[model samples]
Target: MITNDTMQASSQGAQKVILTIAAAIILFATFENKMPGGMIGALGAMAIIGFVLNYIGDRTPIISQFFGGGAIVVIFGSSYLFHKGIFPTETADQITTFMKSGGFLAFYVASLVTGSIFGMSTQTLKKAALKYIPVILGSAAVACLLTGLVGMLVGKSFYDAVMLIALPIMGGGMGAGAVPLVQIMSGKTGMDAQTLMSQMVPALAIGNAIAIVMAGLLNKLGQVMPSLTGNGELIRGATAEVESEEKEAAVDLKMLAIGALLAISMFFFGTLLSMVIPMHPYALMIISIALIKVSGLMPKAFEQAAHAWYKFVVGNLTPALLVGIGVAYTNLDQIIAALTPMYFVLVFVTVLGAVIGAGLIGRMMGFYPIEAAITGGLCMANMGGTGDVAVLAASRRMKLMPFAQISSRIGGAFMLILATLVVQAIA
Candidate 1:
């Protein structure tokens, strides 16, 4: 007896409730006792959730349509609530400072750059991505380990100082992965990290465009290359293929300026809210993103900007910063103890929920398989980046090029705000 509009309305309401709960949980964990070590437990949970979700995405092609990169942001917001909810408040100044500076701005840039660069010149990078994906990912793992070791070893900085670098690395790694690794090794300042991430928006937008181009090239290759066609229909074989169609980019300079102004405005409003509502500094960002999205002007902005400053930074940057800030001030060991035990259960289940739900929705709505896969890919990558996209792509056997590029930026501007609210709920 439920109508589609009613169902959608219910879904929206549920999202709001879920976000509030997650924020409450993250806040509670912060207050009850101190988190020690890294947010190892929570992060590990995120990793597993990330892995499982991508795996599901690859396997269930139809669902990918809706699950695309959006799922990634969605997963973190929800997970933060269920697992990290032992405490009830997130008003710790240390956590806020850690997040606001390092992770906050850095992630924004990383997603945007990755998206834009990939979006425009989809061709060249796909070749490079095919060649270097293995190395790139491995380098990423090694980079994470090395960064952690170096940070721990230099050990010269107190909690306050270490965070300046730590949060940036975490945010950057979560987005572009390897680039941030190099930046730190080169002795760049943390401010450099934020600037680098901001620049990443355009770079990746170009890269994403390239990815779209690559999908076309690969489609041609599919005509000549291998096929698993029992039906022998040639192009539309068993292999799941997703090619992004290029529309006129609604990219606009004016909209970019507006979105930026809105974000800054939200920052100020959030500051005001912090006094009365106890919101975090980045809360403004989340709220700003939501307002932009609900208003639905993002597409116009994208085309207006010529795909220049697309909104990758929102979901990814904000959460990475929030979690990074929390991690910066927090002791990893204690967090490991508090949250790790629940990792496997929480991570897997939530991912399963998204994959199953999004996939079903995509298929029921008659979306193509690859589209469904990209939809699910969002569960991990929207805020996180290549790690999430790569995992889903490989698992789904998708042409990572166009899907990765277009999918990341699709609904991108708004997802950031939605993701932040969800993450804040966890906090």
Candidate 2:
């Protein structure tokens, strides 16, 4: 004589029991080093660990409110775990290899970039494109100015402050931003690349950490001052158009497969183009997608399919991706070593300046201040792709992936060029 509500409760309880049992088994296998090799074991371990940390982070009082909730927890928690030898060596190695050689991050980003760009209305894309670069430039300029002035005040040279500290902080990430700048500066100044790297690495690490925290703070600011943010939207007055474009459709298994294929194909084409273009594949992919969207060449159904695929990946894999990032990219030691009071202040000001400058310029160009700051400012200040994911996830603004990519890839290229010019002038 059980009613429908009772039956539903019973069903839910049973599902929870089943899920708990599965998670327990995975944990046991992972700890015992008995898990299967390859993607199956790696993904299972990441999902279980990531989900548990995420749950705890989301409910942890002030952390859930001001910090990045589960996103930040997953990152720092996983890094701490890995650093402290809590995560099994085999398990750690597996996650690292999977993230890097396995190319999971790239795969995830490809889906996001393809789907997000396709999901937007051509009009919105065009409008945003025309205004986005200016915001990036404004952010970098202010960050450099602020950090340089602070350096001079602290008895450091303005050249070192701007070129070594501030420039690397806004250069994108380690590989694309700092590394290239180091090479360029070393070539111009006749300094060893290793020495240049030693200086730049700490700045990149500290800057990335500040950018993540700032993202969370900005998210909280948006909550407190609703007028400053469009929630996740970047451009203003385009909500109606974006909403219309984002209207969900019934997506079948075949359509999802099609969407996945399309995303991968776009990434593949971008990779192919990069060989000749001397630009990042991501930038090329974004440009190609934008052109396609603007030309009205892609069919409506395919666009819907791509968007569906993006939604699926974002909904299911984000926490796991964060775990991968934590284990693979975050260097707790580097961050710890760079925690001097003065050094920390410089990095903080650099990121803060980027946020403020980008937000102000973005507002002037019809963009939401918070959203603009997160994408153009914070993304530029972060460690590139991984940083973009971490910051965006922290801010709970995953829909802005396209713009974040632009900040990381296109904006990063601009920094490299600027670094080249500055190095030549100084030399």
Candidate 3:
């Protein structure tokens, strides 16, 4: 009884469903005795899982509104599955190997760091660069102080509060924050590095959860108090001066390839700089890209190409990368183990400190309070690269990535320095 068009539509939809099931079956097979053949298997599994979670999160009403859609869901859901032994051990191990040693995370971040910086308007870069650091520092100061106070009130020493809770929360997630911190603390205190790391890991995980959820809440807050947000714009009144539209860059496959080349080259350049200087490659990469952006070193067409590539990557790859994050980085077992009344209180206070501190100073600097709090504060509070993306995506402010990176990289470094000082004093 159906017309020709209806039959075609039904056929196509059925094909899509079949394709999804086939992919899912292939992914599951990769878990069977033999190792899934490397990148292809890993990416296919991540894509299938990530998109499914993304769909579930989007379709759910209230959760989507306040929790920033599928990011949190994907992370938690993947972790739960892993913890519950739903994902086979071999499969989980493969995903982890791909994420860490295979450099999936770095590859993903490099594209974002390169494209976002190059795509930004010069004036916005200049204005934001000059003013953003103080906002980060303010958030850090308040976060540490508040956490320290809360710990003391709960009968924990001020050092335990700041070092264990506050530092990890503000330290920028696992790679940039906890790993380096454990090394530094172990050297200073003669504690086993693994032991120190175990203590700090909970704070980082819990803090990341709080930050992601808070980002959604802050987005809603911005809407209720319209004056407090420039929507995705970080600076108030600065949006008018900036040409922030993505529509101008026509979608071209050649341009996308050029963009990928530019991003990878920039990442390598940062890696090269890291050899001569003792800084993270990402920080150097940010500095290098920002300098070129402000100096007008690249041509307009090059910039446009980079922007186009960034659009392609962000649009196409974010869900898959997030799935990689869930399968690899998020450890729900650790998070669950770390939950305690005092621990929860301290983490909550630290996030609260960031919101209050960044919000006040951001308002003073003519930035929307909600935007500032989320990017400067919550981004610092979340897990490093993935956390920044999750938090910003939840807030619908992906454009604020540059500032969020600043918080995670530079601000995380600052936290490390402070932790060293705090540990020295304690010792």
TM-scores of all candidate predictions against the true structure: 0.28, 0.98, 0.93
Clash count, one per candidate: 93, 0, 0
Rank by lDDT, highest first.
2, 3, 1
Candidate 3 C-alpha lDDT tens digits along 1-427: 8899999999999999998788668656754635466898877777777777888987799878777778778777877776578778777887888888988878888888888888777887888887888899989999999999889999998888888788988998887899989988898887899888888888988888889888888887877789889998888887766755433667688888998999899989999999999888888999999999889889888888888887777787777787777777777878878889988999999999998888888888778888889888998899898898888877878767778888999999999998888788878
Over 1-427, each residue of candidate 2 has an lDDT whose tens digit, in order, gives 9999999999999999999999999989988889889999999999998999999999998888998899989998998887678868888899999998998999999999999889998899999998999999999999999999998888788888888888898887987898888879987887799998888889888888888888998999999999999998899888888887666889999989989999999999999999999999999999999999999999989998999999999989999999998899888998899788888888888999999899999999999999999999999999999999999999999989999999999999998999888877778
lDDT of prediction 3: 0.84
**What TM-score does candidate 3 get on C-alpha atoms?**
0.93
Relative to the unseen true structure, what is the C-alpha lDDT of residue 380 in candidate 3, on a scale of 0 to 100?
86
Q: Write the per-residue lDDT of candidate 1 for residues 1-427, one digit (tens) a residue.
A: 9899999999999998996676555434445544433444344333333343434543554344323332322233333433355433342333344344434333343334323332332232233223322222222233233334444445422322112222222232233332533254224333455554543333222222222222222233334443311111111222222123334455455755654554444456646766876433333333443344445555643433423443434332333432332233223333234343232222222223323333344434333323332333222222334333323322332223223332233223223333334334443
Off by over 4 Å in 2: none
User: lDDT: which is higher, 1 or 3?
Assistant: 3
Worst 10 residues of 3 by lDDT: 27-36
Residue clash pairs of candidate 3? none
Most TM-score-accurate candidate:
2
Worst 10 residues of 1 by lDDT: 228-237
Candidate 2 whole-model C-alpha lDDT, 0 to 1: 0.91
The list of candidate 3 runs beyond 4 A from truth reads: 1-35, 244-247
